[model samples]
Target: MSVVARTVGLVTANLLAPAPGGRLDLEGATRAGAGVPLQIGFDEIGVPLSEVTFVVVDLETTGGSPTQCEITEIGAVKVRGGEVLGEFQTLVDPGGPVPPMITVLTGITDAMLVGAPRIGEVLPAFLEFAGFGPTTVLVAHNARFDVGFLRAAASRLEMPWPSPAVVDTVALARRTVTRDEAPNNKLGTLAALFGATTSPDHRALHDARATVDVLHGLLGRLAPLGATHLEDLATLGDPVPHKRRRKATLADSLPTGPGVYQFLGPGGEVLYVGKAVNLRRRVRSYFTAAEKRKRIGEMVDLTQEVRPIPCATELEAAVRELRLIAELDPPYNRRSRKPHRRPWIRLTDEPFPRLSIVRSVPAGRSAEAIGPFSSRAAAQSALEALEEAFTVRRCSQRLPVVPSAEARACALAEMGRCGAPCTGAQSLEDYAEVAASVRAGLTSAAGPVVAALRARIGTLAGQQRYEEAAAERDRLRAYLVAARRTQRLRPLWRSPQLVAARRTEDGGWEVVLVRYGRLAGTSTVPRGVNPMPTIDALVATGEEVPAPSTVLGASGTEEAELIADWIEHPATRLVQHEEGDEPLAWPVDGAAKYPLPPTA
Candidate 1:
């Protein structure tokens, strides 16, 4: 009937026995037992559970479903370090008759809520009492029931729900408390098993209080397994397999900063590589149920350790991830692993030059190339378009200093597809001029080749040659995109050392240093950190990669292209540079006429 009477009755029944003076001392026994083998939960190297504020909540409704029923009462206890900080409790009119079964179960009668406030009146005060902080953890026994109702109420009331980290005591108990300790993971049973000071009586506040005790008890059980942080508690509620849980320790030492991470498999092979704004969080996510990809799950199952490489900014992390994936060629990476293998559209350097598809950039050749196309088919398509527009020589043999009169011209020359310089049908100077026009078209956007191809497509379409028109259109689109990309990359490729910066989300700056279009170094200036010193330090430490003796290789060509794309991003502004910066001269007319290839 009363709290003290219940306590005395428990003592009389020997559940809580009297101490030395023959007077009941529940506080003494609690204090004595609370210190006994306190299982420390997850290692709190980043943010400990003790530092997190929790709002343990419970709700009583007219029925089980939030949509069908209505919340009759709400209760919450704000706690940190097992000490109560604040509380919120309210009764609300359900706007209808209280069901007899519900009233019988919760003892809440419509008469008692006659003039009580409704949900709209109660939710604001409850949210205010819960407070607002990123560190806040919302706790509830069978959390979905409470949180779901609250969310529904917020939605119906047009109120904003600040989604805080949620911990379900029911899920926690299932993971932490053995069945032997509690027959069923129910609030009343768990409360009784854990020696909760207050027993659950189906009233919201009383149930919430009992759930709070259960939460502490379950957390104590979890400490032995090193599940102590607020994030740890939030993550464990899911049905993550035990083996995966064990691998979570791999992320324990990872720094909480922007970086790239690799999951290493047996024999130290890199299984996967990824970049993240927070190294620790991202690595931890791989071990959690949040990672639902079956391939990633298998990779995680075989992972032996997590390797983190800290970066100065998200941009640095991204570039490093791309470069590492290219270098290591991890089997799990789906893209950017083997850049050298991608096809390139090369303009052969010869008296009668022609467009050709090549694997490597021809190590010593000085010919202009416009690719790194994903496949030879794509490069071939672009070459066909260039040939159709320029009619340059297409024979793939070394021509003699003086052409022989007996040398036969190919059918392409008779069909007017090629200039037939092989047989001297076209003069060497004339063929050279055509090749030069093709080179200019391959290296710049909206050049003669593009203009010719576009005009040809228009003429074909105007004549109702729909199929031919579409084919020409596709070819023109591909050539223009490749050419524009090459134009954008030329400046970076020619510069000996290029430094640039963009403002970061945290009111900071991200500085990127490039050499020959490849990422050489990157650093950041945090919001309040004096940017000049950080910039100077970054420049000092950066490897001033000299102007590469040879052309930019295909090994990191995709990375170079990626950097160019970032530099061209509408949001990015060049903040600093070793050499003067020039605006990327993209065609205002080309993209409108033809669709360009999407950047990687």
Candidate 2:
């Protein structure tokens, strides 16, 4: 027999006999504010069933609908470890006479409630007796009806309702008790099956007593099926598949720390990579009903082993997870798969520089690179926007310092779209001036380019070329987005190195070192300890980063942007910064000031 069954069987076996130590308390208790319900944290392993206090409650109401009905009486029994601790029972005034149908069903007459206290007076006492909070679990048969009435009463009375964790014995009985064991999950049927001392009637106190016994019986049946914790009981209805749950042992070896975890398939291939604030708890959650994602379930079923990489802080774990996903290209990781492969638009180093889409920027010409746009399509749109505003040549051929007289001009030159430098129609000096304007539009100042695009959109709209005007608007928006991002990241790339720190919740310190926008090192200082020595040591031992060759700095734009965001977080404090010739600061109202073409 299960432990709960063995302990509580005697109480149920003797039907109609009062349980030992089951005493009803008529006096009311008082507690402070209606406390918030406690949520089960990711790091919480389990709350043992034996340690949980359950308050089996039942309410007598004037009508079936909570909105129309009023609570007439409150009855509750607090029990722990198959033993009743106390009971609360009281008739409430309900502010009106009992309905004829309610009186016929419950035998509660208006005369019987002559001088009863109101719900406002009775609810606070009942909540206090129930010990409302994490340690207590409220239980009832057809719990929705009873809890709904109580919630409605509280709402009507303008009283705070502490939303305690609730367990519906009806739901539990359906999951645990066989049809042969009980004809139905009703309070009376369950109470009779369990041989409860008190029989359930329409009255509040009797039904609450019966539900306490029923709750114990259901818990006993669930115990053998491994429902030994409050967390397990909460998910009893939607139990995890046994096959998947058997693999929960994989997390047994993982430490309770912030880190990255990889689920490996049979062939040692990484199936999924994820970061967690608590490695063990988060990994174990995959085997519980809490993890409801279908793709994740498939990945879990295929997982043969769990690999943990512990980190000192959440940010470090996040960075490591991103890097691992990029490196391994895990099949189950949908994000950061190609973190370093984002595209950038670059102006070539020829005598006549023309915009070209390139993944990596050329050395010493970081100023000529415009973006790390989300996709090639977005970069193309931005490129087209700049092309529309400038007279630079659009041809792909390499133009000489002096163009040959035999060189043929493309149709773009005939359409007046290009300067036609290849045909010597436009001189190098003239093209140079245009290239400088394009370069200026790409960086430092984008107002002229934005104005040109807006003007083109307005002219197109005036001509009733609305489709073309809408296309111009899209291109202008894409260009402004990329320009804003580039302007935001440029200052971080220009800085030689930066040291910053943020105070952790535990009163410790998380210090980070960045060299040219790349996270070079990180360390933590325990609470009450001097952080200066640790910060100095971290800075000295940090990786040496050479001067960045492109606008992307010493790392991919994504990584640089991540580091820059971390430095700008409100909690972060700058300690030291080695600025280049120019001060490391973003332009005041730079590309952000440029307006996009209006939709209409």
Best by lDDT: 2
Residue pairs clashing in model 2 are none
Please provide, for model 1 over 501-561, each residue's C-alpha lDDT reduced to its tens digit, 9 standing for 90 to 100. 7778778877787766777778777887777777677768887665554444322666777
The 10 consecutive residues of candidate 1 with the worst lDDT sum are: 13-22
Question: Per-model C-alpha lDDT, please?
Answer: 0.70, 0.76
lDDT measured at residue 431 in model 1 versus the true structure, 0 to 100:
77
Residue 366 lDDT (model 1):
25
CA deviation > 4 Å runs, candidate 1:
1-48, 64-69, 95-97, 148-158, 163-166, 171-185, 219-240, 264-272, 323-337, 362-367, 447-477, 504-508, 525-541, 553-555, 569-594, 597-600
1-600, model 2: which lDDT tens digit per residue? 000101122233111111111111111111123323334444334334565677888999988887887888888877776667777888888788899999998999998888888887787788778777555777888877887788877888888877766777887788877889878878888889988889988898789888888877777775555444455555555647767765766776788789999999999999999999888767877876668899999999999999999998777787788788888999988875664467887788899989998887754666677788889998999999899989878888889988887899899898998978997888889999998988877777787778878899899999999899999998998888888877777777778888999999899999998887778889999999999999899988999999976667776666776787788899999999988644666555457786654654
For all candidates, the clash counts are 6, 0
CA displacement after TM-score superposition, residue 162 of candidate 1 (Å)? 3.8
